[model samples]
Target: MIFNIENSDVKVEIPALKHYSSDLLSFNINKLEVNYTGNSNPSIPACVQCSHPAKPMPDSYIYYFEVKINSINSTRPSIVIGFTDESFMLNKVIGSSRKSFGLRSDGKLIHTAVQTMDYCPKFTQNDIIGCGIAFISQKIFFTRNGILIGKAFDFTENFPMFASATLSSPQDSVLFNFVGPFGFKLDEVLADEKKVFNNQVQEEKVDCRNIFYLVKEYLEYEGYPDTLQALEEHMDLKKTEPSNSGVISECYKSLDSSCQNCETQGKICNFCTKKIIETVEAKTNIQIPEPRNHYNSISLSSLYLKNTDFLKNPSKNSSEHNTKNLKQRGILRQIIITGNIKEAIKYLTEFFPEMLNDELCMLYLTMQEFIELIKSREIYKALDFGREKLAKFRNYTVYYRKNYDIPISVSHAFGIIAYKNPHESPLAAFLTWAQLDLTADLVNNRIMMRTQRPRSCLERVFKHFLCMENLYQETSFVKIF
Candidate 1:
């Protein structure tokens, strides 16, 4: 009867050995050599395009060993194979029943049997051999019988086994033997490399001030500096041309003199001469008195006259006559300030011929009253006053242009006043006519246009007036009209 083993199904042929002894005979396995020539037939499906016909070893086939036994005795048989020290031993027993043993492709073993007699027989064999017990060609552990005997072989066709006399376990040293040449001194080598690296790091440190200075120099050479002081300093380093040198010299020469004009060879151009004229004129007019002078004069009496003896008898004292004239001038100035233009003009013509040149004073008083009339919407009064002033100034401008050869700026002032007056005033029409004649004179070289501020002021005022008129016309009152 054929009996299958416990684990692996390998077949074993057992022949009846009829020896009458109680000792079971063990097979001679010390020189056992099992040869595996690979699979007998190609295990992989045939691919017409493949260059090789057979499937390779380590994938297609596995080889292992098996054993079986039968006995006529009534007792059971047992077998054991294992390693002791550097040697291998196998022991076996036979009984009356059949027995079987199996060895898997993975190097494990299993057995099955039953006894039929009262006596037992035993047989054992060790050092059974085959190709190195391996799952893959590279993962082979070579053994003789059940004991490890040699190093694993490459088993790959072209590769040969490499040997080294200095085999060391991984735990034996600081570095693994697998790490080729620099393994032993790895820590020392790394420390040296790190030291050199730190030296490079120290060498790469740069002083910020030196870097900034170099950058500044480069920028100045390229004609741009980060700061105004750097730019000025760079410019100062450049060579000066003759013209620039001359200008500097002239500036220094001017600064050294007390008076720039005194450098000219004129006896009348002394600093004292300039000072004496200004002092005399300043004392004479005394119009815009200093704040301290005004404060001091605040306590003076408001009496109309201190002495009338000069009025009663002018020829008795020249100083008395001077006092009379001063009183008259004061009264005229009061009228001008009161914006009584007609009365002021009459008084000035009768008493003060020299004060007629006070155009700014007259213009100031006139503008104040005129602007009040405009705000009050007294259109007729504003037009009347504005027209009278425009006519007066226009005549004065013409007279100045014809007689003094000095261009008067009065026309522009008159134009501005007339333009600001109410629309009912014929003054703007008159101003336009007068401006045409003035413009012609200006073009013909008789009058200077620069002195005339009237044109721009008139244009602005007229445009504003026209805009107001349009707005008024759009209202309900105009719609009803």
Candidate 2:
């Protein structure tokens, strides 16, 4: 008996092998013929024949036929034969050549000289010697008399087959064994782990600056001292005034007596003469005796004594002083109180020397307070200080324009102040000026009259502030987006 395998649509002859029914003979089978003819099964039939009719064969004497199974669209197929043990000696022809047996005459199995090749049709007689022996025993085993080769016949031929087999398996253990780290070295594993560890360490080493620390340092360096003792110590008493009419008259008489020679000579009095001599000496790199200014001396002495008295008796005011003396004392106190302004200006100049201009005094004060407020987180106090300082300096713009040869306009000054102190309410007025399109209007008007270019410091400052604000807004927008 022979079995046939065929496609549903195509009918073509396939090669096969055959064995006799009585176990008397075996023969090479030719191609089994087939026809489609629109048949439902579309199969080919295998043929078997026996040369001797007198031989009585047992029902166990089964015929075998080789059937070729091929992949779809393939012209050839791997061949395997099915049979019963009666026609073939299971042990005698187990693993022999195609024309020989791998069995000794004593009915025991023996080795045969036959080599297996991948995808080759070279089969020995032992290849089919034990084809159906396992069927009777109901146990599958590889025999020395049988060819039990897998798809691979050698090491090189096994590689691609093993790889594809691994990929097709559903078991994880099989996959790991075949495709994962089955052959990795210990050093390679350690190196990879080290690389990952180093990357994590690098990520952890980044330094972030603390905003609080920056604010604290700025405040300590730039903020005004809270106590009045520092200011009192730094103030010069000689530049101050006395507090009473008797004291004032006494000081004037003293000056008049010391300045008599200057008056008699018709030269500038000793008071004015002393100022000239100091100025000339400073200019000429000369040193001379300090000239007398008796009124200045008496005023300085009285002011020093009064300041000491105030320190000794905080409850007392200078009651004997006249209005003029009181006014002089007030000016002196203001200078003393604000003496640190000069020091603050010096410190600020170290960082931004352009801010050393006298016009920027209020700016300096506000910046100092800003540093303090940030350090303390006293938001409301800072805001109030900023408002007061900005209001005070708002008029300095006009004063600067009137006093300086530089042709800065009030509008430009406002713009500069607004740019510097954007948090202040007065900055709104400056922003309004910037938004008026006045700069272009002025330029157009100047061109019409063919005037020289106007100074544009304020406009430039305003534009710079606007550009900074735009950049900040753009960066923030990108983060949000």
Q: Give the TM-score of candidate 1.
A: 0.18
lDDT for each residue of candidate 2 in 1-481, tens digit (9 for 90 to 100)? 8656464466632223223342222233332211111112322212121122111112222111221211111221211222212233322223232322222212232223354223324333213222111112122221222233211111111111100000000111111011112122223223343455457676775333323223222211221111122233344322433322223222232233445644443322324333433333243322222324442222221121233222332221112322112222222222222222333333334433543444444343444334344334466665576566655654443222112223333334434332344545433332231222222222122222222323233344567889977864655522221
lDDT for each residue of candidate 1 in 356-431, tens digit (9 for 90 to 100): 4556444534544454455456768877987876446554443122222334444553443444553445333222
Q: What is the TM-score (0 to 1) of candidate 2?
A: 0.14
Which candidate number has the best TM-score?
Answer: 1
Off by over 4 Å in 2: 1-245, 256-305, 313-359, 362-409, 412-481
Q: For residue 419, what is the lDDT in candidate 2?
A: 38
Relative to the unseen true structure, what is the C-alpha lDDT of residue 220 in candidate 2, on a scale of 0 to 100?
18
Model 1, stretches more than 4 Å misplaced? 1-303, 308-320, 343-377, 395-408, 418-481
- Alpha carbon lDDT of residue 10, candidate 2? 68
lDDT of each: 0.30, 0.28
True-vs-predicted CA distance for residue 385, candidate 1, Å:
3.6
Worst 10 residues of 2 by lDDT: 160-169
